[model samples]
Target chain A: MKELSLNILDIAQNSITAEADLVEITLNETETELELSIKDNGYGMSPEFLASVHDPFSTTRTTRKVGLGIPLLKLAAEQTGGHIELTSVQRSVDPENCGTEIKAFFRKDHLDFTPIGDIVSTVTTLIQGFPEVDYVFTHRICEAGSEKLVALDTREMRIILGDDVPLSDPMVLMWVRQTLEEQYAG
Target chain B: MKSLEELAKIRERMQNKVILREGQASTRVAVGMATCGIAAGARPVLNAFVEEVAKQNLSDKVTVSQTGCIGMCRFEPIVEVFEGDNERVTYVKVTPEMAKEIVEKHLKGGKPIAEYTIGAAEK
Candidate 1:
């Protein structure tokens, strides 16, 4: 992907397609490392499927013959003297409760590492495009001894909007996008 | 920063049109956005469809969404239109400009541009 946000967007879309009801994304950047994690409350994959998820040739999409999300992330993390891990429970037994977690780490100082893109774009796109699902995004930047946190929770928003008002409304969308951007920017 | 006042205006105007569900839509404009598709620049093409649908005021009738790989990585920026019980129209290697044309022609005018279809490309 062009940006880290795009990769986040890609993986989150994967969760949605897998019938996830809730998807959580967290990015933690410290002095020496950038750690990224995405978790979803959705039907999980089979062991056989999980084994091949990182294979660029094992994609399930009918529009194309290859999958790069897993492989690319793994490569990105490793290239920076870091690593990635994924775990998921079987989906059939507990589709709603079963889920997967993908975590990747990268050296913050790696020259070849991608920059975190406009995360606001990624979060807004997911929340607006799929209003039925709950999305939580957490961004933490750790430098020196202090940590700055910015978070967005769409589930909390649903309580306020109720069933009648959709969060995708133009005004709400504008707010969601800008609020996250401003927080991170500052 | 933009004022929240304008948001209130938008919310008022939207009424309940903001969140579009598939069942409520009559036409589905799907952009292929698998890894291969994204590598080939499907994002802009997909965004173009969404924006054009709104600009044309066809949001009520058309849903611009995405689908994973269609197994046609060679045709990375492929787009498909599905309506009624008719067969789908697959457009291969589409650009933003072509997306706009598809909106104007197929989505709005009820005619598929055959020249842009995969069949045409194959020929």
Candidate 2:
């Protein structure tokens, strides 16, 4: 992926495929470092599968022999003098706490650090594609002794929308885009 | 800044309209969004289709959704258009510009662009 946001989108797809009901994407940016964490309440992978997740050739997909999402993300972080961590608890192993979390750290000062682009687009696209699921997105940046935060939680919107209005409604999506843009602007 | 109050108003307005359209759409546009597809720039292509479908007021007839890899990484950024139960057209190596044409010419006009289909790409 050219942009870190694209990687975020790709990784989130894995959660969707695993049938996650709730997905949380958080970004913390400091003067010298950036961290991205994606957590999903889905049917997490088995230990054997998790062990091979870093290998591009090991994939849950039967269609192709390679899955590049995790590996590409690992490379992107490592290239920026950072690292990635992944943890999962399969539904079979722990039904009460079955999910996956991926955390990637990047050095902001590193020359190879990829830019986080169009995150607003990513959040909206995820909602539009899967209206049944809920998502929480938060981005925090701390610089020069100041901090700015932008956050959105779809669960609150759902309560107001009730079961009648879908989150994917075009009007709602337009509002979401505008709201996030305004937050980023401030 | 936009607030939740605005969303509440929208919800009130959409509630009645949504109840009437609670059925499957006639056409489905599936964009490949797997890792390979993203690496080859599928995001823009998917966004284009979504925007065009909404702009054309075809949202009720056509639903755009994302799909995993169809084992066609070589043909990254692919799109599949399914009409009803029988017809499905697979377009390979799609770009955002091509997405617009597909939406306008193929989707709205009821004629698939022959040149962009997998058959044409193979030939």
Each prediction's fraction of true contacts recovered: 0.20, 0.78
In candidate 1, list every pair of residues with a backbone clash. A62-B69, A62-B70, A62-B71, A63-B69, A63-B70, A63-B71, A63-B72, A64-B69, A64-B70, A64-B71
Indicate the worst ten consecutive residues by lDDT in candidate 1 chain A.
A162-171
What CAPRI class is candidate 1? acceptable
What ranges in model 2 sit over 4 Å off? none
> Lowest-scoring 10 consecutive residues by lDDT in candidate 2 chain B?
B15-24
What are the chain A TM-scores of the candidates, in order? 0.94, 0.98
Writing each residue's lDDT as its tens digit, candidate 2 over B5-122 gives 9999998887676766767589999999888888898988988998899899888889899888898788989999999976799999999999999999998999999999999999
- Candidate 1 chain A vs. true chain A: TM-score? 0.94
The reply for model 1, stretches above 4 Å from the true place, is A46-52, A57-66, A91-97, A143-148, A167-172, B1-13, B16-24, B85-87, B109-111
Worst 10 residues of 2 chain A by lDDT: A59-68
After best superposition, candidate 2 residue B85: deviation in angstroms? 4.1
On DockQ, the leading prediction is 2
